[model samples]
Target: MRCLTIAGLLFLCYVTQGVKHFRLGRGKGGNLGAPGGYSGEKLPPAQWFKQRLDHSSPSDLRTWKQRYFVNDSFYDFNKQGPVFLMIGGEGPADPRWMVKGAWIDYAKKFNALCINLEHRYYGESHPTEDISVKNLQYLSSYQALADLANFITAMNNKYKLQRSVRWIAFGGSYPGSLAAWLRLKYPHLVYAAVSSSGPLLAKVNFMEYYEVVVDALREKTGGEDCVTELKSAHNQITAMMQTHPHIVEKEFRVCKPFEGASENDIKNFYNSIADDFADLVQYNEDNRISADVKYKNLTINTVCNMLTSPGSEPAYKKLAAFNSIILEKSNQTCLDYSYDNMIKELRNMSWGSEGARQWMYQTCTEFGFYQTSSGEIEVFGNQFNLDFFIQQCEDVFGKKYNADFVQASAEWTNSNYGALDIATTRVVFVHGSVDPWHALGITKTQDNDAPAIYIKGTAHCANMYPRSENDSSDLIEARVEIEQYLAGWLGLP
Candidate 1:
């Protein structure tokens, strides 16, 4: 026993020593470029261009605030292989939070630099003044693409990358929309892109998506319970609103579920509420729950903090603030189910028009709080409770509101900026069937000349097909598509 114990101690010491030695050796290699080759040459200058880093850069020391014109924000970086520039959505630009965990691991696998550049007015990338409707107009997609272009030029000069370095601009959700736009705007700057669950087609149907959510929930939960409960809650809430109009109209006018919510509002309500749950289920089937479950309410605390902040105690100031904003912007509603235009589109089952209308309503509302004029918000008040929900949207947008200014924004969206057309660049779009935002991802009705990957049961962005558990046949096929496409671009083995 004593001998065995001694041997055990020796083995433990041996393993510990090996680990320490390995770490020390890693340290001596001077940390840039792919791992595993120790040629004993003196480390290259800090600016030396390496395809991948020998080891990941220290996350703590890596974050530094960089200025681009009026905007200032901290940037996190992985100083390795071909740099992957990740443009985030409309929210704060902490790449760590936005891309979830997939990016960190992906950096290691590809031996590429991972850079998270925060969008202007988001996180540390704030402009000199608070955001409001008047100034919010500047946050247009065109302006953002310019910012990205500038940032890339700055980084290239600072690092003195060997020649024109290959970069991959990628993102999902709002950022995904931005990614597609950026690729079109600056193809030379971006070698390749992967826009997951991105909504490029701005003219999408917001209300029908509520229906999709309902169908998805019913399909996943295996019951009318969720549908029944949600519908009941919705009807009860709507009827309660009619009775206590003040409570809804003045105090808590939240963004109504897609479609001004019909007598079948209950059914519509359940679908909207269940959509996210269905997304989770489609991605993770092991934890499926009842149809009657309000998953958002359950994960509200966790999810809300990530998406928006719940203010104060007692009655919850955040909720109250949300109500106030919604009431103020209630005028700019969309063509609800009752509207002749909407009815016509529905009767024809016009997918494109419905999608465009929904996207317009939802995006405008979410973006409405930042509009510069009252007219814009008022125009779509019935369909979108812009004023009522502006505060809530503000919580997520991380900017101050300027109702008058933002109200003027309706025109730009209405006019349609620089015609949306086919791109000369190699744009790769991906989407999940279950996502409410899927309508926006549709570049064209039929597959266009550009490459696209739509995972059958997937949800948002890097979520549907998890990098960790993508052993299924469909996932494998998708992976092959990605690998082949990227390989062709990268000339990889």
Candidate 2:
């Protein structure tokens, strides 16, 4: 789950009493990722609430049902206790986060109320009947933040918390960026924030994404042999796309033949394979499953072993087998190599359609986080550049979203939300050393209050996962330090 990290705020500073700032960093002494949190129990139900469609624009009076999950089992309404809120990510709102996250563990110990709020336009929070470019005008981070601010006010009024409750925000990936921005934009509203894997900067090209991906491969495995094989495999496909287009079609078993395929088509084919590996490494924990897999514990290391195995020789065969296995899990008989369909789905905006259009709009307009492999390193966010992005914007959202306008928007986003020049207090930035997103995040503390930390060799949002016996010692220490900070902030002694 990921979304644009933007928002607005009101002055609630004098409304509270004791909200302290926390400055914390990482624990240095272990491997990168830990096992995914194991659970076999059914969690609680989700409670939906009516949220304004555009809190930022008063003229556009529309409302949508925003989905939220709560665990007040530990809360005492009679007493003003802390609220551990999980800000939802790009995808649908999952109540499982309440149990899968670290906050629930903290909730029981601290007698806190745990809640997870779904982002607008994602999950069941569909504002309009359809997600046309015209309808999505209100789907910016600015509106989402306003929605959050208004939601807080409404929830407080409904529960009668006197607007003085301790509110601690938590999120990972894009949501992590939102958590940090929430505190920055609405300092008076949010008491504190724990932003894990939050990319703070807004840029058109995000090449460092792959740099870290390559680094993750080497660091996690303690060698470059695996990476070397992967790179070789990737290059082999590129060569095949050029010389033997027929073979490329036959082996990849694409929905359509590779004959007369444009430059974009070939690049997209490569991306299909590239993104699969990326999801594996990004969520590179033993218990973490691949993006689309029925295999319970499919992992990057295991996949890498398969790619480099003695029998899996020749890059084409390895790629074909890998694709076959992953697609078969979803009953996909043949790979859908239709970028045109990809474009169509990106615009469908239906409940079931992937949220590609919205995310692409965000990239073209707000942050050009395009993953071009040609940059410094090549792994994640690769295979494209500004030209392709510009063309896609025009095709997707009309002419207003040109490169000049997008570049300017990116600059303004950084300036407004403290992308490059962010100044803040009462927030701790958490990152994994091998996470590509951290290239934009605050890994190094510029100010005393905003201390960025890294769990060495870990992947994206690794610390955000629930603690397990298999968790690295460094991750355990990282969580402990975070708890200490939160406890001290709320004056829990």
Candidate 3:
């Protein structure tokens, strides 16, 4: 996930049709006025709450308005039903989450209020004027948990529920980790949590991520030949970079020539190509009805078919041809893997920069989830390594964010969060076997209190999406099991 962000491969486009209407306070909500609305449901208007800037310091009185959405359509106000809080991730928090997702289904079943809280420095929840390294000190997971605590307390008082109402937190991917941590750090506030495809461990050199990608390729249909050809293609490209650099540039349709490119540029170029496969396997069939339709056809099986097609062309040529297909679909004129360009883009503190700069800062300070290809058995070559990513931290943020600092930061994160050894109860950790991020998540049952759901053939965050008719039986059963756990926790039959 971090690798895709670093390589600039993650597209930030959400396709929503029709007009979006916004209301200030909790009002009677209707349909989103869109044809593809989720069961003809509408997302509640955006709301704001003043949150503390520095939750650790008692003297600091500074505050900022954080964005959130509330949908109490299914709330059993007289009975004071449970509250389902969906934690936003590295990107902006879509209000649609308050109306859709499997959590909304659960909210309907339990007659609970659905609230979506935007993470600080993401979406409309800007805590500081700029994302400078000094300003980003308040953007850690510790502060985020504090935000959730304060928000929950404020909501409880606003609704006059006090301690009677139970709060169930939900999140996927990076937010998934935050959900679990929220329950661990503030168990009194969060009764139970659903952490789907959450990476619990903080690792510096995550070579296993790529190993899982190789494993997925080898296990899919026609994937055996695809894996062999992929390895050979990467070797060929590595050799050509050393001798015939011009040919490599021409074949890959690089935006800029590599005649005077820096070593980091070459490494980034390799990473951009490898990230294609990683992106495919990571998302796979996790596409829900609300997801971007552009990436629906791009899957593990689709790429494997292209790589294993019958032809006299060399494997490297076939690999380049596959990249062209991606370039066309993404509407990218040519590949731009310049290290300088990436640093320049990330240095911008404007809101238009989205959460890329903020997320990169988090990686440098807290989690070093660098997906390096150092393993010899990986289909992708060894051009990109831990040092490559660590250097970017120093280059983009500052000199103090070096390798030693990163190592200490990761160690501190694991130590503070308890990593996989977290002593929490009523937290269900759900993961897909094909999801590479599951390598760091808890897959086995830790105890009766902290059980894990390891879905066999699903991809990243598959259990969090809305139920689809085309879903595998394994996924349907997993959702049913999750419902059972939530029902028991909520004191329902």
* Per-candidate local distance difference test: 0.39, 0.66, 0.76
Compared with the true structure, what per-residue lDDT tens digits does model 3 show for residues 27-94?
Answer: 00110101122565555788999999999999999999998888989987788889998886666666
Against the true structure, candidate 1 reaches a TM-score of 0.53
lDDT, candidate 1, 1-493, per-residue tens: 0000000001111111011100100111110111111234333111111111111232422222332221112222333246667673343332222222333334444655556565543333434243443434444565567667767776777756655457777665556656667777787787777665664543312333344445555544555544454444344445555565444333333333333545333332222223333233222221111122333233222322322333333222333343232222222132122222322332221222212222222344433311111222221112232343343233323344334433444345434433234453556677655554565456343434367776655444433223444234554566567656655666555
Q: How big is the RMSD of model 3?
A: 6.3
Worst 10 contiguous positions by lDDT, candidate 2: 20-29
Question: After superposition, which runs of candidate 1 have C-alpha atoms over 4 Å from their true positions?
Answer: 1-81, 95-100, 103-106, 222-225, 236-421, 443-449, 464-466, 469-480
- Winner on TM-score between 1 and 2 is 2
TM-scores for all candidates: the values are 0.53, 0.87, 0.92
Total clashing pairs for each candidate: 56, 10, 0
Instruction: Report how far residue 387 has shifted in candidate 1, in Å.
Output: 9.5
Model 2 residue 350 CA deviation in Å: 3.1
Candidate 2 lDDT tens digits, 1-493: 2322111001011211111000001100011122245356566787888888877667976777887878788899998799887776555665555555576777877888887787787656788888888788877777777777887777788788857798888877677877888888888889998988887898776666667778788887788877877777767777776688777677766777877667776566665666556555665663332223356456667777777788636966786777766555444556665556556656676666435566667666677776666563333234655566576677678888888888898888888897856777878899888767788888877776767777886776777667767778878888887787788878885
Candidate maximizing lDDT: 3
Q: Number of the top candidate by TM-score?
A: 3
